[model samples]
Target: MTYFNKNMPSGVFKWRGANKWLLMLLLISSNQLIAKDINLATAINLMLKENPSLKIFELRKRSLDGAQYTAGLNPEIEMGLEAENFLGSNPYTAFDQSELTVSVSSVIELGGKKDARKNFASTKYGLLDAQRKINSLDLISELTDSFIDALATQERIKLAEESVRLSEDIYESVKRKAKAGAISDVEVKRSFASLKQAQLTLKGEQSKLERQSVNLSLYWSEKQPQFSHLSGELFDFGVVKEIGQLHQNLEKSILIQALTMNQRLAESTLAVVQAESKADVNWSLGVRRIEESNDAALTAGFSIPLFKRKRNKGDLMEVEAEIDSSRAEQQIALLELYGQVNEFYSLRQAAIEKFNVLENEIIPALTHALELTKEAYLDGRYGYLEYSAARADLIQSKKSLIDTAQSILNYGVQLERITAEPIYNDTAQTQGGDS
Candidate 1:
């Protein structure tokens, strides 16, 4: 079975013969299965809870949380025992002549390495947190787009169905006129052709809706959609923010914030590398046994690595280079974000203008024209060809209106994705009203 078949309710298909009787029996015994209704809020909540990618980021955040503790920890103590001179010369053969040494040692960090490490880890943790937020924003953006797509598909299906109905009506009228010798068989055939085209369009739209349904289900890692349909208005217009306000709000965007956090993390790592330039001191304390004198004494010493400058210079350079790279990336991201906001804002305005013209002018005119043509055809003043053309025009105009409305909603979603906030908010309305 196809993915669509698996997801679809069984009630959609008819059973044959004995299976039909069984279906009737079952239907009589219980209520029919209905698809669940899903809204935007419910869909987003499900994605947040069940999206696989978001869960991966959540696990990473937890792992980094544990790593933060290890970052600031000191080195572990060490212990050693030696019988160094026992195996040398004649004394090596005698246990009494053996010199034994036992010691404990640990490195004491210098140059504030511990503090630097802690700061670096803290910065890294902050970066991870920002990354999680970025992932969340991305998921939400994707889900929002998919939801809008599903809604558009629903609208398209409605338009297609209406077109099919209009075509069927025209075909029936053409047949009636042909039988009365008022129209030729050629006109009836043209009507039939238009009907077939409308049917194909409806079928295509139905297939698109199924695919869209599956796409929405994928967001929550479901094999099929839980809901039969989405519930929302397609042309529900909301307040749009000013361009300046949207730019200012870009700072709160997860992408931009993550970039800033990355820059800070690089700088913190540089500090850590610099702190490591001063080598830590390895100090040891021990008790030594002198075999000849049969006496014990305490010993203590410290050691440090040489060539610190050359050893750390490469790391310092690498970190410095990364800092510069991060800075450049941040600048690029800012420019790209600005461009995205400007582009979507322009497209949104254009869509709004187009939708207004179609909704207020073109659609109504086409609808009225189609109605007049239908009446004229029924009264023998117009022919089937004229009626079919008018019907097709009306259908196309309605589809165009739907497309424009979807464009406006999609552009709004794109803008919201970049800003990490709703561009259309109550505040926009309040401010605009006051002005």
Candidate 2:
């Protein structure tokens, strides 16, 4: 990057300390009264609390809790009563000749069916938890993307303002030179045109910032944005890991965990279906009364499911196929994850290199060139066209720096989203070990 120059406007340099806060406040317009600045941490907290998509997972967990309860309950008992032979014939029709029976019955599950069902339900909970994490990561990734866009826009607004400022200065100088007859009137017209274009660009960027801010706030359901600005070092991406290092942590992604959980849930379902294949028995014990003998006797009986039934055979095959499908899906997901990691890793490395060259070489050179061009124009050694070209080159270089920095941050976010781990490894952000 160019060395901080004593003669350059303060806006060209990075804002620091109190000047940063002053810049933030000055950026606010008269129309915004209660607006404040927000950081990434605050945006994340608001998104987690107010995001609508996560609420469904909470409701689904409640529904599964009910399913687990239903799965654990035993078969319900039935009560039955029967009377016969009271009204049909002389010997068997009257109440004294009638036989009466009362019974209680229920199905007795076999093959540990209840336990298998309970395990099946319990296994779903683990799967649900994993899916929830995946959804959360997805939402967080989106929020971060919007936050970065808004922050980048904020930085662009500053650059646009700087451009307008320099354009106004050039326009004023050219007008004075035209009045003194040192410069042609055509130069004044050209300078004025450039100044107008710069003003328009500044306005356009400001409008873009408002839209970006609204997008960031909408994640938290705010129709009207509360924060006038998202404050951060958008240029500072910190130390990033190499593509190979990022690949090693591919298993850490929530997507991989979710796939493993799916396979497990499928396997657990197979167990439940296997348990179901073993038929259960229905049984009853009762008291029978013989009116002719005026005596009571106990009776007991049981019936089993058709011994040769094969209805569950189809279900077992289906569950086994599901397990196979889940395994295949895991393989596919790993490949996709690897591909995504590689894409962002390569892109981010290139972006970082681009940013360094712009910051250290190109911008500094253009800044010095623009200063020299302005001096030459004033001394009649160079034309206004040369001065204008230098100013445009410097402005474009600064814009490139901002855009490159934004690209670097976006690539890092994508890598982080893919790995479900921090892609940025700046020492300052790392947590200290427990004492």
Candidate 3:
């Protein structure tokens, strides 16, 4: 006997089929049951751990550290065995007249060459460290921007979903009025068209959200995002710093520090080159054996180059030129950073003003107008066109608000990148609540 039944409700099967998509929509609509709830600080820490480019830079720094250990050491000692007066005479053929010498030779650095080389290597290592800091800052800024974009896309998706629901409600109302002879069939058809457009907009926003998710995940080298949604507020406005404060912190920026390190590296290199101009002495010590006399003696000698100035003039001049170049580059970098800070600061101020007007005034006014239009349409005092126009205006205004908020975040990230400091600290919530 089999216990099987096929007489289940069609509604149950329909819901079962639709449940997967519904779950996905719910996940996108809210931050619930997420696999990972990453905020700005968490994301940055993850990138620092998993980002491939950052890891490469760290490895390079370690390699430079290893090179520093050998910088101050003398050259390897050369060992040799020499035999003279062998096979030249009958007595030498059997080793009676043979002479053999065993020797070791090494170049002794002069003019503090060892110390200068060590200093140069130390400076180079410091420059690498500075470069790694700059790279990390750049990566963090980029990740912040991408994370904000993903969050904004999520908000847009919610708005699109709202638009779809609104359109559906309006369509149902138009259908009811048409059946009661209060509105024409043409009006019902127009309402249905608006509903379809809203659905299309929702689909488009969902697609955009997926792309933004992929972009954010790319920061940590993940090809696919593990989390279904980002959990952060997009409209977290904070007090903007003054231009003078940003300028004052400019010296502390990783880029400026890197440039300063470069200048020091150039100076250290010049010192090494100047030290190289003094010739190093090569000295040898050995034991010689004279088989004919059957006696052993010790020998020592030293030699130094006579034309040190002519030999090293080119190298010294090249390093001098490099020092001049590094100085000019450092100055240029400072000026460029200042210009960037000012530009982002001005833009941030503008974005804040725009966001305030849209969030505080325009959006609320439009929402009220939309409500009034909806009531008028329900009473048959307004046409489908007017209702749609009002709804469209309100939706556009809301999107504009999101855009302005995104701009604020973008400018904030740029400011952070320039100053190597947070413009808006993420405290797990938006400041003053979500716009």
* TM-scores for every candidate against the unseen true structure: 0.88, 0.86, 0.85
Model 1 earns a TM-score of 0.88
Candidate 1 residue-wise lDDT at 45: 88
Considering every candidate listed, which one attains the maximal TM-score? 1
RMSD of 2: 10.1
RMSD values for the candidates in order, in angstroms, are 8.0, 10.1, 7.7
Question: For model 2, how does the per-residue alpha-carbon lDDT over 226-334 read when each residue is reduced to its tens digit?
Answer: 8776778887777776678788888777888889989999998998888888989999999999999999999799998784239888888899999999999999999
Model 1 residue 126 lDDT score: 80
**Model 3, span 62-168: residue lDDT tens:** 78778788896778899989999888667667778888999999998888988998898888878888888888888888888899888898899999988998899
Q: Model 2 — TM-score against the truth?
A: 0.86
Model 1 regions more than 4 Å off: 1-35, 379-381, 427-435
- Higher-TM-score candidate among 2 and 3? 2
TM-score between candidate 3 and the true structure: 0.85
